[model samples]
Target: MTTSTQPQAQAKRDEHTQPQAQLAVFDMAGTTIDERDEVYRVLRESAEREGARFSDEEFQKWMGTEKHWAIRNLLTIGGVEATDELVDKAFAWFRDELARTYTANPPSPMPRIEESFAALRAAGIRVGLTTGFSRDIADLILESMGWTVGGGEECTIDVSVCGDEIPSGRPAPDMINKVMEITGVDDPAAVISVGDTEVDVESAQAAGAFSVGVLTGHLTKEAFAAKNADAVLELAADVVNLPQVAAQ
Candidate 1:
């Protein structure tokens, strides 16, 4: 593989410039996609369907983890041995249910997503999406939104990184790292990542990016700040309009 020149180019760009964000990465479900809490419901349904007795709290504990990982954890918690076959079966069930339900209802942007996209574009920042959903489902949501990245909108998504695309998902830095790589913004300091979960905040923080948490989804106020989010907003779109963004 060829070594990327992004770092060198970024260094040259930064030499005479104040460090500023060049890209923004946002999460999908609960972050920007309004699924109305159906995801967790489906997770629990999948667990139960596979004969695993995962309670709501137990299932929520694994939020933002890869589906297979979450399924194995649920299986183990419910005293079902997590053999490869069993884990695959449970994850498959969850994925199928998610696809079916979402296909029927599709997904809409969370409140303020359009405003956020507008702000990002006005500031000349590129945008990307990182999500725990697999690529197929993420694509499904994107198509439904008519907001497919790099197409279908004036304020387009430059990249979309789904959980299965990387070695691991949130709480790990891989997704954020991948965004930086593909966007040609080598410095995490020049990136802003916003999401509605602790895993989202944690991933950006671990990657050394500015982590913003939004409360438009499953989290409460104190719970958001507890994630050590660099900033907390009522909506993800408010992030690009922050005073710091203007400086960039």
Candidate 2:
């Protein structure tokens, strides 16, 4: 064998010895969990409080953007003066509405989410979450779903990187990078980031991580295709049984 072939063979051997430390990052609301339209739904309901009305088209366009960006755009397009307090108040209303909705209709684990996690764990791979939802909200969702990080009778997620945890949010690579920092994983090629939006794909691509897109969320499969998504599939429910995921 040639000198160059040795490293490739060794790498393959190493992969079999270890679970490959394949870190997987998931987006919360809409991606791995329910609560689709939660943002816009809350925005529309909070219109009266903001003294404005949000256009459905415009709101849909801002799907993957952070809450602040969406709120800023809503105010700007509505010709309303932007103030720190006003922005804060608007988001507060959205959160309040979200909390109410969640209390009444808490999100259940996405189809196959538990199965996918179990498979990854069984394989010794680590799983983490990256979501636009605030850490506070993330905590609530996890608690409701009974997710534990280490291991248990149920499931354990390795880590979570939330929007508020870092200065920059999705469409930025910071969240994924933070997951890397927390997990101590260095190679992006070894990591697979999954989500249901362009922002998630962009973040993964920016971080040089393999990206998986899903049609389970707000964005269509074609939308993910347009972003040059690495792999497109059904919801997390389908993740566990896939040959690709199974091989991973």
Candidate 3:
């Protein structure tokens, strides 16, 4: 099932004070790399291959979450048993198909994302990337985009936390916490988590960080607002224009 903690978390964030952003953690896939939703398309195909079927709404609810978990949930929704063996088989299929699709039509960086990253770093704010993909797939996408991960001067991102590296994925605070730990950012209030889904907003709130939803992916502005995101932007690259990010 799709998990969320929007109601209680939104109220908590409202009462809490937000500090100026020092570390910006971003989600990959639709938020950073414009992969054209191939991941979701492959996910559906894999599920159907296993005799399971679901609607677009069901598919969307799993967006921004770990692929394995998403597959298991989607299988259950389609009246499948969701056995570990079945889930693993489907997951393997998803990985191979997505990789093949990406190879066929390489993904590109979101518009002006490089400039946005540079601007944030120039303002003394560190940048990070968090993703629901495993390390191998995440590395592939990053390599294709010509981005390097590390704290060195030549690196494009300060840190990268993948789904496999964390204990849990979105709506859980683990990945964001990992980013904070790696970036040496102590206060969650000083971190901004940006992505293109409601789970992204829920995850940020769960981590006590500011959440900025972007329309660069699938969700609409109204959908983001309903999730109680701290702010919403027209594009991922437009994050640099946010008052909190700009002030940093």
Model 2 regions lying over 4 Å from their true place: 1-21, 47-49, 52-55, 151-155, 240-244
Residue-level lDDT of model 1, residues 1-248, one tens digit each, is 12221212111112123357788899888888888888878877777777788666677777876677777888889878889998888788788889899989987887778777767766778788998888888888888888856733574678899889987777788888898888788877778888887777777767777778888867787886666666778888777665557665
lDDT of 2 by residue, 195-238 (tens): 88777777777776667788877677777777777777787555
lDDT of 1 at 229: 68
lDDT (Cα) of model 1: 0.76
The predicted structure with the larger lDDT, 1 or 2, is 1
Candidate 3 global TM-score = 0.93
Regions of candidate 1 where Cα sits further than 4 Å from its true position: 1-19, 151-155
For candidate 1, list the clashing residue pairs, or say none. none
Q: Estimate each model's TM-score.
A: 0.87, 0.83, 0.93
The backbone clash count of each candidate, in order, is: 0, 3, 0
Look at candidate 3 and give me any clashing residue pairs.
none
- Candidate 3 or 2, higher lDDT: 3
Q: What order do you get sorting by TM-score, best first?
A: 3, 1, 2
